[model samples]
Target: MLSPDKVSAHADEDWENAGAGDTIDVERLVAVVRRQWRIVAVCMGIFAILGLVYILTAVPKYTASTSVLIDRGNSQIANQMQASVAAALPIEDDASVLSEVELFKSDSIGLAVVDKLKLLDIPEFTSPARSPISMLRSLLNFRTWFASDDVAADDIDTLRHNAADKIVADMDVDRIGRSYALSISYTSTSPELASKIATSIAEAYLVDKLNSKYDATRRASEWLQERIDELKQKALDSDLAVQKFRTAHGLLSTGGQYQLLSDQQLSELTTQLIGAQADTARARAKYERVKSIIDNKRTDAIVTDVLDNSISNDLRKKYLEASKLEAEISARLGPDHVQAVRLRSEMAEYQRLMFEELNRIAESYQSELQVAQTREKSLQDSVTQASSVTAAAGETQVQLRELERTADTYRNLYQTFLARFQEATQQQSFPITDARIITRAQVPTAPSAPKKPLILALAMALGAAFGGAIGAFREYRDRFFRTGEQVRDVLSLEYIGHVPAIDAKEAGSGNKDPESVRGLQNGNGITNYVVNHPLSAFAETMRSAKIAVDMENTSTRCKVIGVISCLPGEGKSTIAVNLAQLLAMQGSRTLLIDADLRNPGATRAIGRHAEQGILEVLLEGRPLKDVLLLDNKTKLAFLPAVVKRRVPHSSDLLSSSIMVNMLDELKAHFDYIVLDLPPLGPVVDARAISPMLDASLAVIEWGRTSRRVVRTTFAVQPEVMQKCIGVVLNKVDTEKLKLYRSYGSGEYYYNRYSAYYHEA
Candidate 1:
């Protein structure tokens, strides 16, 4: 058995252990779900019903689908040819395909389909069902109130526009993978109408493409024709200007070859002058050679022109023969031979004849030289004249070249535009679109909306999620005592036991004896329950409280125990009365006192008919024996508080010297004294009388009282908390308590030990 100090130290150690850390407890979560399972079921059932209602009320719609392939292959030839003559069209890509998909959903296509299909005449388009917001506005008559009387309702144009908008709203368009294919789908109540609308939208898109291309080509052709005419006139004007400028500047070109006449004349004059200069140089050389041979009278010098003269060649041959004979005669004969003299005279005569012939040739060379010089001078004069005329023509050639280049550019442009004009004309006549129908829209066989099972499943899942959230909130706020573990962990006090609530009806139904029957009829069943059901859990809990009191005050002669609570209606008076009865039944002299002067619940339960009680004993000096009521079965004495009027100063009365002396005097007659005190939360009467108590028992309502309130109550009343031996969880519902059971707790094994208690 532990003393109060040792018990307190042990509680402190347990508190430290409990406060070490907070972690998730799976058992606690299971317990919470068990306690709130009904709420979850109710929420799930409501959501399921709503889902079913929606499914039953929803209108089913049929969907029709059509596929359009963007056939770039069909336009490849035209695009390639057009690219050579103009800016190339952009190549088809993912972005271009997606753009085509968007075009299928555009307002232009939608409006075209609406008009072509005469959708405004159909009931689904013209007189469609009103939306919830529109219905609400109609109910309020807001349009009539805000609009002018002159405003027309549902005009033809407005109806057509609305039909177009409705068509667009019901349509879905998307690209199919990376390929150049578009999928268009539409939904409506009628399968045939859905198919018709989808097909009409696709047809409208393709037709719109063809019409756009045709219009663009026609415009391009008209512009190209205008440009061709303008370029043709400009090319003709440039050609005429070039011809007129050339003729005015005397820069006429040679026929067939476009060379200027002045340049040809200069070229011919330069060639002839070169020939004349060569002839003059030859004639002058011949004349100089003949003159040198005649002036020096030398016969050794040779000239080609003189050599070609036959008379000069013969004379030179004869002179050579004679000189040879003269040399031989002079060598054979002495001083002056007649033959040598004769041969030398003959060589002289031959030299004279050759000189005469050379003179004649020189005269002819001089005449030829004069003629050649005259011809060279005449050609030089002609070349100088041609050079001056060519130089003048060269100066004027810059402007002529400019005019000629301008003419050539205009001519090329004219030809290019002429080709472009022809291509555009061809395109306008035979227009082609890039898109074609791959799969025509077909009527759907079945409705495509309002999946009942999926909706119901989703609704149930949402409901479960919502219910779980609420359950989590309830668990977060459930900070109250439920088991002995909570008492030990939260308040750090030994948990005595649970005092199960005994109803008046149940108490009377079990009892057959007159005394037990009388106690049940008077609402004193709970106070006398320990005596009637001695082997029951209620009686067993009272025995446990007694044991805790004994252990805490082992050395004390008189144990004055106070039964207190944090808040009102916690059944402290019942615990006090039952504990005292249990002590007296075990052959101990026990005295139960109703110490709460303001609300004497113990006196009302066991001593309600008493005339005077603790007030008389404390204020009027009445003897305790005179006001005490005796229980015949248990031999227990009770002191009840019979308040005739409101007692404002309840705490002052409990802490008074008269009350202390009265307790001290009663201690000599009683082995154990149990006081039913007011709650510590609202009043300080329990704390005021705490110093006189040997041990105190805190009575807390199971799962109803908050741990924070109880802790605050003890914190404010430190003396009461120090004297408190343990805590008792009162009014426990055994069935509900099972949900809060945890491992190692007293209630966890209650089912196994429940057979030991006999209530009937």
Candidate 2:
């Protein structure tokens, strides 16, 4: 049994064991989970209820959609072009049709829509608002939502313009994919209105397209008419210029051959004059030179001397031949040999031939000069005749060129006027267009705002997160260690035994019911296998541990042991009583002592009074038989604490020489003497008395008295701990025991000990 002081000491130790922060207690966690299941239920239920409410109240929407196949309308356009154009175009790729399609999307087409629909009143096409809506919004607090309220229009045109701009927003035009087609869709509060607008826009666009084609055709016709007129005038003017020049110059009949004949005659005459002049000059020079020679009147005489000297000429030849021969000999043979000398002699003969030829040519020049005089007179006469013919041809060419230029001018003017007349005749045949409606737009039946499901789901998720936060905060603040497993795992201790809970009625094993603490086989004993099946497992486990501990030393077989606990009512005294009787039943003599001097809950545990027990023997020095209480059923003996001193000084008496002798005597008489000591915490009694024992077991209430008290029970002095065998955790809940699965046969443990109550 644990003294009050010991229980207090153990509690302090257990608290200190829990570090910076205590860890989660599984027993407490189980209790919390049991208590807070309703909280979790409420949170989940709230989320579900909110989801249902959102589903019930939210507005439902339907999407309205339609599709159209775009039509490029190019084939029809090409056919129209082929029918309308007269001249063959040199174009490889014509852009007129594509340009027309672009024109349909232009502001010109938009204006065409305005014209057709008479939408000049719409704001988009009308005059600027001039601080109208903006000024109103700034003035009124409600302006953002009611911005258009105070806008003032100056005239019907402004009103129509604003309306037109607003209506334009009700229509859409999209170029569909890569094709030349366009898709247009309109949305409106009224289905019919949207359909009307879409269909109207399409009709208006087609009208604009037709107008584009018509306008292009009209412009083409007008331009071609003007060009044809200009070309006709140019042709007429060219003809008139040719005719007028002929009239002015009077040689309009000169054909193309006349100019060629005159040019040829002029070229021949010019050549003849040049030759005549050259001949005359040559004759005059010859006559003058001959006369000078005949008269010897020329006095610059170097030429005359050379002409008259024959000897000098012969010397020149001989020297020339000698030089030539020397060159020949050097090239062909030796320079100073006999063949070279003979060749020099032959060259001397030919040297005279030069003077002979010169004399002959001078004689011939005199005869030729007389013949040239006669020819010069004849050539001069021919040149004069040719000059007269060339003059006549020049006059004729000038007249014919003037006539041709006049005729060209007249012809160009005439042609220009005639072509203009011809082009005007072609304009009335061009084409135009008639516009009609195609597809209509439809109104949307659903709003484009507020998708309910997505929004509500987000809210529910947020609510659940908040709810879980509330649950987690409450779990962090609790403070006790609630399980034996916590002590085992957290403190790193061995588990020895689990004592079944002892009820208050069947608690006393010392005097009233000794049989209850007897053998493991009977139906009605304290630790019986039949009557108290749950306790039997605890007893069996204790027996096994006892054998293991005792086997380490043979002297342990007859050693006296003690049972201790963390607090009062933790089944320590009961465990001591049952254990001793069990050993006694096994034919080993056993004694059970209740040694708590301060508070003896152990006496109450055995249904005995704590009067004149240990205190009477120690203080008055009486015989041990005066206080010993013996039960015969299981052959167990008991001693109760007689002193109920608020401050008991029993440490000296228990650890004294007399107590030591008494313990030795008991050890000799019994195989196991069980002492139920005062708790080690409140006083020094248990520590002082520890050296008199072989081993001790600490008892702890399973789900009560926390880890603090249990550890303090074990953390006594080394003298006390030397006798500390292990521990016993008492009063486990059977149904909840299944949570610890390592106790594979825990149900049997619970069932076996639980039968004791039924049997009683």
Computed on alpha carbons, the lDDT of every model, listed in order, comes to: 0.84, 0.57
Kindly state the number of residue pairs that clash in model 2: 74
**Candidate 2 per-residue lDDT over residues 1-760, each given as its tens digit:** 2334545655665666566247765654566565455666677678867777776775543222333333334434543554433332221232533443454445544444566656564333454444778666665756356656565655554555455555555455555455444566655444554554556567666666556555665676677667666666666665566556545544323445334444565566667657766766775565556455435633222333345668646655565767677778867888667767776665554445544434454455656666666666666666566667657666656766666565565566556544543443432343333323333345566653245666567656766665656656654532223344465544344456565554545632322433543212222234333124423555675575466446534666567686766566666665776676667666777777777777765565553443467777766777777677665556666666665565345788888887887787777777878888776656677788888777777776766665665565565555766555566677755444544323323443555555643323
Best by lDDT: 1
**Residue 660, model 2: Cα distance from true site in angstroms:** 1.9
Give the top-scoring candidate (TM-score). 1
Q: Would you give me the overall lDDT of model 2?
A: 0.57
Worst 10 residues of 1 by lDDT: 512-521
List candidate 1 segments past 4 Å from native: 1-25, 80-94, 128-133, 139-154, 215-425, 509-524
> Which window of ten consecutive residues has the lowest lDDT sum in model 2?
516-525
lDDT at residue 122 of model 2 (Cα atoms): 35
Model 2 residue 648 CA deviation (Å) reads: 3.1
